[model samples]
Target: MFTSLYTASAGAIAQQQGLDVTANNAANVSTQGFRPDRASFSDLVHTGVRAGEDAPKTGSGEKLAGTETLYVPAGGLRQTGRKLDYALTDGRQFFAVRTADGIRYTRSGSFAASAATNGRFYLTDAQGGLVLDRQGRTIEVTDEHPARAPGAFTFRNLDGLRKTGDNYFAPTALSGAAATAPDAGLRQGYLEDSGVDLADVMADLIQQERAFQLNTRMVQMSDEVAQTVDNLR
Candidate 1:
């Protein structure tokens, strides 16, 4: 009976974690370049003496395993007529505007040149910071002439891109060095679409909900059984 209780408790904990992950994914469904997280579970250790078992001892209960971030790419390109809108064709990520916090990275290419505050055209992200060029230098557009357009941008290894939230990415040591110059041609009027699959997320949400409910019931049932066993004594 006690083992059953432990098992149910583990189930409840795991289910709760799953619910949280699902909720976050649902909330970010519309977010560009958002990657959904998934929950992982493991069985609990058992404390019992085994009879003639050469292997490790026996265990019967489940455990709430730690969750891992799912980095599966999502969303596609959404063509926007804006000149600065860019999307990576091969999982390359663009550097976000620099902030006091640190340089961040993101796959989101929805960029716009904001008005100059001090004789400088500030290229910023949604949060407004100086965007970085291939030289790891903040791109400052001062020329008012549209003819002097920044042509292309490129990265060394896009797979090492790290998510900094709000559709932002940052380069890691694993990301390798930035390219000497912008090699990838800039597509002036294109925006990256979010890769999230709404149908898949909805299905996962439903599955999580049902699993949580079932786990709750199991815990309750285990409690009742434990109480009944104690009452007989």
Candidate 2:
């Protein structure tokens, strides 16, 4: 009886976690460059049980051991007709300005000239940070280069790119070293759209909600059983 109660409790907790992740994914369905997160669950340790003279059996009690984050990168491209808006074509991630705090990366091509004293143009992700140029320096475009074509951009590998939030990506050791030159062509007058699928997300949300509700009922039933057993004593 106690084992059943534990199993029910675990099921409820795990279902709740699944619902939370689904909700978050649904909320960010339209966020640009947003990678959807999935929850992976593992079963807890099993306790041994004995039935009559038959061989020992394992108790059915189980709980959610833990969860893993599944980062699924799926986004689309959108055209903005803005000169600074850019997006990678082959899963390539753009490098951005780095600070002492840490290096930031992004896929958002929306950029603007920094109003700082230096008067340098800064490439910013959705959250707005400086974008790095081929020279490993912050791109400072002036009116003269305002309409310059993206002819010089390069990268060692595109898949090794890491997420830095706000539709940005940063190169990781897995991504290899930055290319000595920018080889990727920049597409001005366009923006990248989020890869998330709203229909799929909504479906997932509904499934998770149902699962959570089922688990809640299971836990409640288990509690009633436990109470009845206690009263019998």
Q: Highest TM-score: which candidate?
A: 1
Please, what are the lDDT tens digits per residue for candidate 1 over residues 20-123?
Answer: 87787888877765656667667777655555556466556555575544444535667777666666543443444576568666656666677765766656
Best by lDDT: 1
- Report, for every candidate in turn, its global Cα lDDT versus the true structure: 0.63, 0.59
Residue lDDT tens for model 2, 17-56 = 7777677777776665565665666667654475565656
Taking all chains together, the TM-score of candidate 2 against the true structure is 0.75
TM-score of each: 0.77, 0.75
lDDT of 1 at 227: 87
